[model samples]
Target: MKTDKPRVAIQGIRASFHEEAAFRYFGENIETIECNSFKQTFEALKNKEADYVVMAIENSIAGSILPNYSLMMGYSYPVVGEVYVPIQLHLMALPGVRFDDVKYVTSHPIAIRQCIDFFDEYPHLKIVESNDTAACAKRIRDEQLTDTVAIANTLAAQLYGLDVLERRIESNKLNFTRFLILTTHENNKKKGPANKASLCFQVNNEVGALAKVLNVFCHENVNMSKIQSMPVLGKRNEYNFYVDIEWEEAKQFDNSIRQILKYTHNFNILGEYQQYIEDDSPKPQTKPDNTKRYITVKKIE
Candidate 1:
């Protein structure tokens, strides 16, 4: 009954950004299990229904998805790798529908916010919030809504046979989302060498207590890429610190972790995985007019 292809769980329907990220990380041959929410995505992995899970952790324009951080803590899934996907929002509708025919625009709240600048020009078009961007596009196609447009990626438009009314409608063209590739702890141990690590811990609520922990990383020559603090529920003034660090040598990071453990309480190492670096090169144009550049979806599998 076992197959060679990996079954990846993602927090959205087909053609959603999460699915795009999953395909980018696991390859097109992998089967995707769509979950309605990030919590459900983690559950699929925990229940052994999925080989891996692709979850979005942060976005360049909208900042970190804090809820996902809490979910990671509760689930304790090991992050084995990461991928960065460029977010390019496009307005699409039925084939014959023109720009003026769009009476309402729908998409995920985050996607709607990112394209505010473009929508500002059309005050008559009502903005509607949807559960998922691709879902909005799918709705328009299934219901044959000629007057409704959806803001989503080109993949959604292509898959649903919707014509793009407007291209790259996002306020910022440089917007990108970072997704973490997570797996079971047993599978995580078999991964290759990792240069990056994610950690969580709680420090005593005292002056300079958090700074002291950071100093230990500096002394060990470990580069702290990110640090986030979330208030501990039901506890006053206590916070859980989530940190990501990168190092060139294994011993340096190991020593840093040991020294940091001495000053923190409930220290947890979320995962250690290879860091993703975005490629800086000229991408081929997907259109004849060269109006839109293809969003590079890198493959690690």
Candidate 2:
């Protein structure tokens, strides 16, 4: 009943962004179980088919995935860690197939939408919507469709043996998606020291009720990285506030949680794990010189 590698469930197939996120969090040595939907990922974990679930929670351009928030609250799985994946889309086709030979482009609806600006220049190519971006590339390889192109990532291009005709075709190059690592076990030894925590609680509708909790966190010097509110099902005028907080010292976060409990109800700690911080250092600016010629020189053997 024991396997050598951990089976991580992802919302999409291998070579998709979800699988890439999993590879980022857990090393590439692990096994990935593909799921059709976010809910199915949770079910896989619950059914013992997978050891972990990598689910996307938000995106830089498209915004939060509201349904995932609902799924998290419904399943109550502990988030062990998180990772951010840059959504770099590329146009790929069979080798030797020129852009003029392509008559159609296919990808996920969201992926297709992100590359609308690039597709606008080529109005001759018909746009097709599919459930997964990598699947489109896989189909092109399996069916040998010379007229169809797939919008996917470099991983897909390599996995499906396709050539990238166009690189970084997404409208917003800085786009990225934040994925949460969830597990059925409450404690994961692999997760390092905790600095950030995810929580969900409800406060009375009375005035200053929510402010009181925020004030507690502010007084404790705990930085609130993110906060979201979702309406309680079948309950009018009631909402659950989900918050993510970070701190310099553990005491700061601990004190804030204790003080906020007095002003909130139905408080729940979803997860407490180390926060992944991205480097935001600015790069040096350079001026474009049209006078300079840039070319790759090939060396003869």
Candidate 3:
């Protein structure tokens, strides 16, 4: 139950994974607040209702939590840190709830997709969407509803005192959730091994505009970890790029960022921090499929 004693607003209830990630980052007893939407989380931070907001920006199975990406840009907040929690999705329920007795499965979209194998097996069971995977777990715990279950992490079960009837229900084994720690208070303090930086920018609608913008990094031999595009409102054929860079914050880090800034009309450097979980996990034997480029970007719709 250790904590930094800061009021934290997360997107869901106590048992939600956002709370879990927040606890991992800030420790327990964070003077928690719950926000119904990502916007509300930022609002809480702005209005000083909460000192920070912890949220998921991407997943191993789902790419670019698009709304969150835009939200980060819309808000005047800074990404202070990050965490990658291993998503050990579980089929959890109330006591005496047998696997055979379940008729409805509730969770977030990514949770439902991760446990596709289980849903496929229980063809008669309906997959219901909830605001969050752990929120569903918390709901189940509060109501003690029969014949209903949730897919969430072990943290949720531990928080709500629910029985994990089945563990590791994700269709894939290498499930992981990447979380972002956001604060408006200029929290420059970060734990060691910080290597990545998230940035966003919009370029003038011109031929080869993006290429020119990206060349800034290529010239510096800085690696581009990820790049995603979102359309600009009322502007067809124009989009903004959200970029994640494997940045090396040496004496030259700031200079490199400055050079990139000259080429773009609008830009934002969200955060420069270490990969919390990946830095701690065992080195992968091979390049994982989770990092592979996809033809169609899957996002929260």
Candidate 4:
């Protein structure tokens, strides 16, 4: 079936996790614009080359990607929506290659860190870092490296014609990454109903200045989901506070934002969009058969 699809810019190759998140958010029909870096993903949107961008903001196992927060502030791109993708790292290699034959393991630094416990069991294997997980798998397949293994998602193994030597190799089985759907200012002007918002501000350099701002949100009955402080560049004793707040009543959020502005400096509303709610229970895991040409992974509940 052919249909017009929105072009979504993602910070990795086609089979990377970012692309998976984009598929989950925009449906499988959407077109993807691959960008080498997160900054480049935003550049695609800025240059009108892509309609939207899917960028990872944080990982459950690795904490937040602080550089992305800076990019959000620098570009001022509006976050229209969000999605959470499970980070399931798999050990993949050339067809018929066994785990015993693997000599080197390579993947993105973040992916390698998550699977540190799994790799600890194999001390003989040399660990290497790559720019992207899917790219690592592609390299192994293209070069037919029998001694090399790639730590990546199941999609990578399927797309690159590699076999999964080990599944769910990440140290934390519950790992998941949250991604933000970003669009240009004009495109986001009529954004859908928003129950959550991300705000960035700096408090006065005085005692109780920050607390006063928190008190305002409390008074308005708004729920603060996250609060992170980043040091201000070229300024001493100053920091930028990034906050995520959720609200049931729109007026409460509006009232709180109005009150907060009076208590902070350089206040900026980074985004206002629907919050991504994760499923409560874990989903059943299914092992892929070797004969299957393409393996499809179910979304984590």
Candidate 5:
């Protein structure tokens, strides 16, 4: 049982966006705990040490959080709610140092990759990996290293009392991170509307297997948002598909899964969740505001 404080386990320190998302969802009264990895968050929830787990699943620049997709499947936890955070990237360092003096950098791998443009120019500097971006800021502050730098946000810089060497170091300013708040419950029942539903499936080798799966949503006029294929863990001949679809199908019940089960051997309804974060986008003000376009993920070069 959760304590009276309602602990929420996030994958980083207090100023990390996952922690921010936890605070936003659970409120100020709830206590926040830190885990070293996404897998750890699941264990905390299972052990009843945390009431909820908040972690990012996708980013505007990095594309689908393919790793977390596997975590979601393995943990078998419900994708309870989604928190969208406009990720702001900034470079921070010890006081009075300029960007030119940044001899080394430490940050999350994904964050380093996202800010490749800036670092590529400074190829002479060594890049170190940290578990999270904000943690890197904490390291720079706690270690009190003058030559070392960290790539994070203003939030981390402020929390750790580091100087912003450069603001907005991300390759693209349109970057945003989508976080999933996971729980043990499988149902999508909530106090509000759910705009999106995630599903997973695997198909037998056939000429029109994918087309049949597409037809399931097409026939029902349910728009699909994202679809990705991953190799099945221990099977060389099979592949698994992870997909997100518009959430209108839940009201249709058996009518929906019956159509989907026609071609796929196994299918799972991940959950009917909502997208709460997007870059430069305002929160929907009314019910059924389907006017916004699905964020198209271009093929990674």
Candidate 6:
């Protein structure tokens, strides 16, 4: 049963954003194993059903996915890489359907939230939350739902043969989801040069304990790009600090980690991999009413 292509596990069906993120990281040649939930993706990796798991860690609009953070800590999988997929949601329906013909719009809950402003302009359209964006599109096509439309990506529209009624319907054009590429193998053969490191540790509750560890990063000239604190389950007033540090020189990161260990306990280096840096250009701010041009129907006074 050996195949040449690597099997990637994702939390949703094909054409979903998770699949898009997997394709972005592993290219289009790999086989995608769909799972009903994020936990299932990790289970697939654990059971040898998949070679890697593409899991969403955070989104530009929705902030961090806290449940996923706990899953990562529990599974203790190594994050080999990362990828950011732009959440360019589009409204699509049957080929001959028009905007006025749509009565219900369906998408994932998060996707629905991302386009709240667009929905506000069309109160007549009822919102239905689905498990996956692409699944919504597939359901519309499979069931021939003439009065329903789906909010999904371009891949869904093309795969399901639905015409896009509107493009980039998400409230913010800069909205994106950050997905972590995790694998069972800690020393993944495909890992590139490591400039970024993910670590989790606990510092005492006393004053300046957390600050002292951060000061070590500053003293070593290491850039701490992100820090997240999760409360230790069932423990009072105790937390586990998850930090991501990047460095220009490898020595800076090594020295910082060594120094921080003196100030932090239960220190674990989760992963060391090359950071995925999107364009460094300044992002333009998106207004709440940016989708005004697409407002065709007038509200009843």
Q: Per-model C-alpha lDDT, please?
A: 0.86, 0.85, 0.76, 0.85, 0.76, 0.85
Worst 10 residues of 1 by lDDT: 291-300
Model 5 TM-score, 2 decimals: 0.83
| Model 6, global lDDT | 0.85
Give residue 108's error in model 4 in angstroms. 0.8
In TM-score terms, which candidate is top?
1
Model 6 pairs in collision: none
Cα deviation of 217 in candidate 4 (Å)? 1.3
List ranges where model 4 is wrong by over 4 Å: 1-3, 189-191, 279-301
Q: What does candidate 2's lDDT look like per residue over 1-301, in tens digits?
A: 5367778888777689998888777767677787778888888777777888899999998888889988888888888889998899999999999999889999999999899999999999899999999999999999999999999998888888899999999999899999999898643654667999999999999999999999998899999989999899999999999899998899998899889989999999989889987647653333222332211112212
Instruction: Judge candidate 6 at residue 93 and give its lDDT.
Output: 97
TM-score of each: 0.91, 0.90, 0.84, 0.90, 0.83, 0.91
After superposition, which runs of candidate 3 have C-alpha atoms over 4 Å from their true positions? Answer: 1-4, 186-194, 275-301
Higher-lDDT candidate among 3 and 5?
A: 3
Kindly report which residue pairs in candidate 2 clash with one another: none
- The better-scoring model by TM-score among 2 and 5 is 2
TM-score of 1: 0.91
1 versus 6: better TM-score goes to = 1
Evaluate model 1: give its lDDT.
Answer: 0.86
C-alpha positional error of residue 68 in candidate 4 after TM-score superposition, expressed in Å: 1.1
Q: Which stretches of model 2 miss by more than 4 angstroms?
A: 278-301
Model 6 agreement with the true structure over 166-224: per-residue lDDT tens digits = 99989899999999888987427655679988899999999999999989989998999
Q: Write the per-residue lDDT of candidate 4 for residues 1-301, one digit (tens) a residue.
A: 2236777888778589998898778766666777778888888788777888899988887888899999999999888888999898999999899888889999999999998898898999999999999999989988999999999998788778888988998989999999999999787753467899888999999989999999998999999998999999899999999999999989999999888888999999988998887657764333323442222222222
The residue pairs found clashing in candidate 1 are none
* Pairs in clash, predicted candidate 5: 84-277
